[model samples]
Target: MKLIKLDAIDSTNDFLKALSSQEELDNFTVVTAENQTKGKGQMGAKWESESGKNLIMSILVKDFLYDNEQVFNMSVIVSLAVIETLKSLDIPGLSIKWPNDIMSDNKKIGGILIENTIKSDGRIVSVIGLGLNVNQINFGHLQQASSLKVICNVEFDKDSLSFLIIEKIKEKIEFWETNSALFWKEYFNSLFRRGIPTPFKNLYNQNFMGIIKGVSSVGKIQILLEDDSVSEFDIKQIQMLY
Candidate 1:
């Protein structure tokens, strides 16, 4: 577990990607930054965090999955790892909103963005980006944002928290290839709003009500619609209303 700490960087994922391309990097090589000039998030949304007040990190992983078909499994493993790490810290009401939004008490606390590259020899390399609000107390206009500090009302050591999360992710990856089914089961168990009526907005900009039934192996969320039918939607096609 080689760690690289930067005072500032454009994006940790980009830095790690460039490094991996230049040379053979060790597995679980982590890059975390105190400030990001252009932080990224799922769906092109900006991951806004106060400078030095959040965990902005990206990890390099290789040989976790052989091909692209099992890419969604990366999400399952990483999401479950973060959930379990937070649960151990006594963060209450933690759940994974579909895909990979870390939520506590129905408020957004963290998110994950995974970028994979396939080499000519058919090997896959993944850059797992995780952004978690740690000590920040104010979210100017973001109505749905919260932090561990606000939730627990105590300051947390960001260094210790990040290391614990990294360890948990490694633990999951260690047994994933053979025990994948078990990881999927735990992921669904920690899924947010599972089997509960929820509101959603589709790509067509229409509001509809549905219940989350299950997530496809390819990462599409299965929702039970109003007409008693189950439909699958990708992240771009559906937005779960909090």
Candidate 2:
């Protein structure tokens, strides 16, 4: 559980990748950057934030899984881990928007990116990157972003807050590894807009309306259709529209 904190870095994810090849960094080794020069988001989206005003870090976890299918569940692991961390901070209305956005009052407050790499020893390693909006008091032109400072009307000590978050994540990870069913159940309970009809655009660019019924055990999002039946989709297969 050693943490390496950097004043700035090109990207914490990249830093971890570089370290990964240099003799396996132990599981729970964390690298964090106060400012990320080239932050990355899912699907090549850009993750940007005002310098030193957010939480940007990557965790190196070796032996995360045995197969490719289990790789996809990393999203569930990270999202639920973060949700638990935020809840421990007494943050209100915090919920997870599947595949990996953390939301509060329907506004995005954090995100996670889980990358899997195959090691030379035939093991899989997971790099879980998390970017959380913390003490930045204003969203300004970033219409969809929000911060803990904005919500709570007070600033937080960045380093202490980051450590607290990591501690919560570690605790949740253990809980998830032991009680998976209860983990998923708690995760589903924190799902944003669950049971409420929402609009989404599918991969084919077709629009559809469905209610979030919760996620299947296999990790696909279960969407309750208008016909009273249910369907499920992987990430990016369906984009929920705000």
Candidate 3:
């Protein structure tokens, strides 16, 4: 694991992507910053983090063995790794919201954004950017955000947490390379609100109650509705209501 630590950066993901283009980056190469001025979330949303108060990093996966279609599996692996790391810290109510948001007690504590590079022959390289709230005690007006210090009443060593999460991610990646089916099963089981009837809204603003069935191999969410019909949705097609 080649790690690059920065005091601040525009975005860890952007830095890693730029690095990959300039030179051959080792697999599992990581770029982390104390402050990401332009951190990103899913769907081009801005990720807000206080300087030196959270985990803001991006990992480069070069020469990935998986094909382009299995890119969703990489997201699952990274999400599970974050969940496992938090669990090891004795954090309660750990669950992964669909796609890649880390939730605890119904509040988001972290998120992930994955960008893929495909070659002419269809080989893939993934740049995964991750942000996790650590010691931040306030979210201003963001009511649904929480951090480790707020949730567990303890301050944590950010470097130590970063190392543990990276290690867990590498472990998941190794396991995924060998036993993908088993890893997928566990990923489904770790989903937030899995099998529970929850309120959801569509892009058209239609509201409905749906049970979280599971995610497809390609990362579409499967929701079973009250009408006994199952529907599949990609990100941004449907919104989960808290």
> Which tens-of-lDDT digit does each residue in 162-241 have in candidate 3?
88988988888777768788888888998999998899999999999999999998999999989899999999899999
Better of 1 and 3 by TM-score: 1
lDDT of each: 0.93, 0.82, 0.90
Q: Which residue runs of candidate 2 sit more than 4 Å off their true CA positions?
A: none
List pairs with backbone clashes in candidate 3. none
Per-residue C-alpha lDDT of model 2 across residues 1-242, encoded as one tens digit per residue: 87898999988998998888886677889998889988888776778878888989998877557777677566776787777667777778998888778998878999888778887777888888999999886777888789888888878677776677667666666676777777677778888999899998999999989999998765689999888899999876889998
Q: Residue 41, candidate 1: how far off, in angstroms? A: 0.8
Model 2 poorest 10 in a row by lDDT: 168-177
**Per-residue lDDT for 1-242 in model 1, tens only?**
99999999989999999999999999999999999888899888888889999999999999887878899999999999899999999999999998999999879999999999998889999999999999999999999999999999999888998899899889989988799999999888889999999999989999999999999999999999999999999999999886
* TM-score (C-alpha) between model 3 and the true structure: 0.96
**Which residue pairs of candidate 1 clash?**
none
TM-scores, all candidates, are 0.98, 0.92, 0.96
Error in Å for residue 65 of model 2: 2.0
In terms of lDDT, the best-performing candidate is 1
Backbone clash count, each prediction separately: 0, 0, 0
Candidate 3 regions with alpha-carbon error over 4 angstroms: none
